[model samples]
Target: DVKVTQSSRYLVKRTGEKVFLECVQDMDHENMFWYRQDPGLGLRLIYFSYDVKMKEKGDIPEGYSVSREKKERFSLILESASTNQTSMYLCASLTVRTGRGTEAFFGQGTRLTVV
Candidate 1:
């Protein structure tokens, strides 16, 4: 099975601290995404990369950025972690040529608590 691995299952960050969350995929999928899941708000996209060295901002890109230097690795960066930024961070990937309901493979998720 295709697997996405996240660096951390839980992260505690204080306000105004830089943070990096790593993700790696075993399958050579072309699409990767980072999303923040908040209570009642659901998952909101933070960024996505369709290819190596390429990145795109998603719905909630403010205070966050992403990097994809290699085909199998993607990273999410928080310039300054804030309390409001506290949420469950999810990393996911899918094939470039997708079929209907081809669900994305997800990491275990990083539960970040910005104090």
Candidate 2:
């Protein structure tokens, strides 16, 4: 089975601090993504890395960045934490080569609060 793991299940940081959220997938998938969840906005994609060292900015990448140094690992960096950036962050992985039937698997998510 595919396993996606987030480094933290919950986090709290003061304003102006830099934060790092890590994610790893045991499955050798080709695609990994980071998304932030809000009540009204639903899940907004922050970044996507399709292959090692290749990444694309998603719909809500303005205040975020991502890194994919290894195929099994992906990291999300919050340059300067803020209250508005507080949300549930999720990591997902899937094999792009797979057809429509393939599905993405998500991690438990990290709930971050910026105070």
Candidate 3:
């Protein structure tokens, strides 16, 4: 079974503070993604990495960044937290196959609150 673990299930931070969200996967997937979920916006991709030290910006990348220094770990960084940035963050990992579809494994999710 593939296991994706998030460092925190809930987090609280003040405005202008830096925050870190960490995720780990055991399946050795080739792709990893970071998404933020909001009430009506749904899941919006913040960043994704296909290989170590390689990252691509997604739908909403402002004020956020990601690091994939190791194959099993991906970290999301909020450079300066804000109230509007408060949302549920999710990390997912998947292996892409040429001819077949692949399922992504997700972390439990981290609900962040900024005040």
TM-score of each: 0.94, 0.94, 0.95
For model 2, where is the 10-residue window of minimal lDDT? 94-103
> Which residue ranges in model 3 land beyond 4 Å of their true spot?
97-100
Model 1 segments more than 4 A misplaced: 96-101
lDDT of 3 by residue, 1-115 (tens): 8899999999999999999999999988989999999989988999999989999999999999999999999999999999999899999998766888788889999999999
Model 2 over residues 38-111: C-alpha lDDT tens digits?
99998899999999999999998987888999999999999999999999999999764446676889999999
| Candidates' RMSD to native | 1.5, 1.4, 1.3
Please give the clash total of every predicted structure, in order.
0, 0, 0
Model 2, runs deviating above 4 Å: 96-100
> Which sequence of candidate numbers ranks them by TM-score, best first?
3, 2, 1
Model 3 C-alpha RMSD vs. true structure (Å) is: 1.3
